[model samples]
Target: MTISVERAFGLLRIVCEADRPPRFSDIVGISGLPKSTVNRLLATLGDQGLVRFDVEDKCYRPGFGLLSLAAGTWAGLDIRRAAADEMAAMLAELGETVHLAVLDGDEIIYLDKLESAQSIRLFSAVGKRGPVYCTGIGKAILAELDEAQREAIIAGLAPRPYTAHTLTSPETLRAELEAIHRRGCAYDMEEHEEGIRCVAVAIRNFRGEPIAGLSVTSTASRLAGTRMTDEIRPRILAAGRRISAALGHLPTPC
Candidate 1:
């Protein structure tokens, strides 16, 4: 296992340094590995899309897998770093948990979570993924998607009622999305977890499409009064706007 890993990285480095895609014979010569061993390693890499084999030219180069992996890592860091101060401010002002998440297919994956000081706070973690139909962040992002795209995603989801407040009906969820669009925000009224509620706004991209969502979660009783609208709504929207601007949201010319 160790030998294979070392050889694979060895081949990867060799390919990376080449002026152009290196031929099979060139790799074998440079790596000092047997031709058969080099071929096996290259084949394994090709299957994983870690290396692109140019059959026509009979050469090897780095593949989309590497690019995709690197891009995702950098993008996650960019969002987390950019939103650090804003999330901290929210945490301080409300003394509640704040979350940063991005849409991953039909789910919203929490990338960064800042827990509140209180003992009874929202239950979640950095790697946690949840249903788009029930969570505030997920619904916020889902609201901004195009009709066809939204419908496609909804067709795949089988909404389960996590609580009585959970929007289970497809028709009902569609209506909720419409309201969210008009209001430019979404709410979790104890939908995913009883006693917890959230208010969130979409973080749009340069093309004015939702790329992520930001939210604050607190106990339902605390958010029930004027706090939800007078306080949380504007604060979250302001942060969402800042994040959207950072993401290069240039409004389209009419």
Candidate 2:
């Protein structure tokens, strides 16, 4: 079953990445699979609307089902371009690494990052996934979510100690999240990576739901003492508000 599934995806890749729509022969040749297996898998893919047989061109092309999937994915997240300027400005002001990430299931996925000019900076990259219960970006986002959703996420978490400072107990993490909610920001005090610290705030959509998180990260020495609260926290919180507003979120009247 696994081999069959792999072969199916193998054929699907050949069709999807071709310069033009690929014919049956093209897929078989590119995939190096038997003709019978290719034909059977193509039929299965066509049935699922992942690929289609183009009558006029007599070639395989990506199907409307894939477009439907893509649309659903793209509809929820479109904040990168809107966030670029704010990230750049934050990086310039702090001379620290800036990251934009979104919650994906039980993890946080980095979407964009602005490199710090300083010789010392946190090690991270766009597309990297990190534990939701530990990182500043993840905790900030969790703090902003509705209680039911937040509880559900917390209940499902399997946390471990990444560093001595890491909060491994669910009860302790719950308390930390509550504090983040009150402060409107979250902090990672060398919890995930030793010698690294960061401040993060939630980026919301028009519905006022946290769709992403924005964070400024630097070495512990750089962010030590009152710097995180007096400097980094306020700036990142302001940037989050601007980016959320750009995405059409309106803050509730206080």
Candidate 3:
């Protein structure tokens, strides 16, 4: 079938902007397209496994095919392979879940995860995607975006509360991202999921754009009262720096 690339991209934008799965009617409403046209497009997307319709909820969400493509892309990235050992060593030393993620549109997609030896660990799948405004790794990568780009991306998001701690307001999230840029690190203070805390730093390539991030996630109870900056932050930053170096980034003293 000959699909219009423009129409396909338009549908993709609608899906990516949604906070949760969107109802068929909602997509039609948002796109201002005819019901028959929308249905045809959705049917095509479904056949490709890029989107799945939930009969019970009557909503459409991203499907496994998108994840499979993402995984294949990640597998081909030399940076991910080069940093795998370092990520594993860091996870082993800290006894916390370590993640390597890259930005996909307005979200962060986990490319790799190193499970900790500890009995208690945050359960995160390798191909899982999370909102940039709520995750440490996402925020770390977002810190590299310029103000205009950041605003454009934030404007496109339909923020929904994932947890009580999730930042739902764009104003507040923008302020937090600004701080992350200045500090060179970002924190997830139970923003995406309750009981989870994380610290992340950006991995930049030779062009100085953040292409990925490295993060450590653990329960809030474990991180509480501990000097994270004095101890954990350095380690996380080191890992990020190492990945950046492997990606051809040369550090200039700040």
Candidate 4:
């Protein structure tokens, strides 16, 4: 049976929005499409290697084919290439691990990292995924979301505590997100991982939607004693603003 390309794309959206790989029932619940139709779409997408189902986990996630697509897209307007010098400068100035990330569903996918020269540094690899509820880059991007979208994403989350300081309660996490909006920046207070702290600010496009985030991370010992909020926040915000400007975002009246 021939399927419409648009409908196939619609099914793809459901998997893309999910945090963990979603179960068949979960996809059915969210997409509101008929079960048979959804199953057919999933099968087609899986056959094309655009999605993969884990037999043991009984869940579906994006597949390597999507990475190929991303690589092609990235090759054209590579944010890492465009922003590397600025990130390097920031890393030099701050002597902390600098990261560039973009939102992928309810997660932040780290695209690039600039390690600090400091002897004591927090190690993070490029291509790492962090929860949007706890990481600084995640919060920075989340702050750009409207209430409804934010609530919907949270509704779909299965909060797994990564550390003692992680925000496990939805209510508490929402409140912290609110504070991040108020402050025009976000912080990772050992939420995603113990002993690590990070600060971040959002980069927006011409439409004012957050397209990326820039962050600086270190051990709690370094961030706790330093005046990071006062000193580093402005620098991070400046970098984000510059990137947004490069993406043609003009400041609108708040």
Clash number for each model = 0, 0, 0, 0
Expressed as tens digits, the lDDT of each residue in 1-254 for candidate 1 is: 69999999999989988998899999999999999999999989888888998889999989789998767854764778778899999999999899999999999999899988987746678989999999999999999999998999999998899998999999999999999999989999999999999999888876788988999998888789888888999999999988877766765668
Determine the C-alpha RMSD for candidate 4 after optimal superposition of all C-alphas.
14.2
Model 4 lDDT, residue 70, Cα: 69
Tens-place lDDT digits, model 3, residues 136-223: 9888888788778778889998988888989889889888988988878999999888888899998987777888888888888877
Report the C-alpha lDDT of model 2 over 97-143, residue by residue, as the tens digit: 99999999889999998888888645578999999999999999998
Higher-ranked by TM-score: 1 or 2: 2
Model 1 reaches what TM-score against the true structure?
0.69
| Cα lDDT, model 3, residue 130 | 86
Tens digits of per-residue lDDT for model 4, 115-158? 88776545467888878888899888888788888888889888
What lDDT score goes with residue 145 in model 2? 91
> What residue runs in model 1 are displaced by over 4 Å at the alpha carbon?
1-77, 252-254
Highest lDDT scorer: 2
If both were scored by lDDT, which would come out higher, candidate 1 or candidate 3? Answer: 1
Which ten residues in a row are the worst by lDDT in model 3?
A: 1-10
TM-scores of all candidate predictions against the true structure:
0.69, 0.70, 0.67, 0.67
